[model samples]
Target: MHIVYPAVVSALLFSIGVYGVLARRNTILVLMSVELMLNAVNLNLVAFDVWLRDRLHAGQVLTLFVIVIAAAEVGLGLAIILALYRNRRTVDLDRLRLLAETPAPTGSTSVPGAVSPPSSGPGEGP
Candidate 1:
């Protein structure tokens, strides 16, 4: 059980996760890739913790904290993805633009060099 073995495995997992996050188009798949990366980090933490023989088990404790954060991230990420799917009917990251402006409503005219006069309010007449 040499340290190199676990380190190599962690590196491979992280590489794969990075590929998934970069190459995948689906939002859910991207989230899963991020989780994979986090798990790889946890593996590294435990491996180093055991290798160092720390009395405080700081590696394991930190791994636990990372797991907790990962869980929370998954929960919130899934909720957002679900909401986007419900509204947009697709989770393709390229097509999903939350801040993109929508087209104007139908029957609206915008002509060049066209100016309309302003109307007066109840208390402010022209």
Candidate 2:
């Protein structure tokens, strides 16, 4: 019944979630990690709410809000990941460079999906 028990478990869950997010190369795994972290937070909130015996149950209410947000995040995140997989055919975070933060090399020619200049037609004069 001690708050310490739930708190310790929450800490452990959060730690694992952080590790997964940092170490996993797959975007889906990272999303799952984020859900795990959010769940840890939810566990803490409910535990504290029960411990404090709040009349309004604010902690539980906030936990519900967090759950709603997490659901939306999962939906949108999966949608984006699926779209990327369809377009580029890979889910490895390191390999997926369409959204790379670094600028493209100046000398690089023909960026992905870039349309080349149209050739002069026979009718058009040089």
- Model 1 steric clash total: 0
Per TM-score, the best of the predicted structures is: 1
TM accuracy, model 2: 0.77
Best-performing candidate as measured by lDDT: 2
Task: Give model 1 RMSD, 1 decimal.
Answer: 10.2
Q: In candidate 2, which residue ranges exceed 4 Å CA deviation?
A: 98-126
- Ten-residue segment with the worst summed lDDT in candidate 2? 115-124
2-30, model 2: which lDDT tens digit per residue? 99999999999999999999999999999
Q: How would you encode candidate 1's per-residue C-alpha lDDT over 93-121 as one tens digit per residue? A: 88755464345467443211112222321
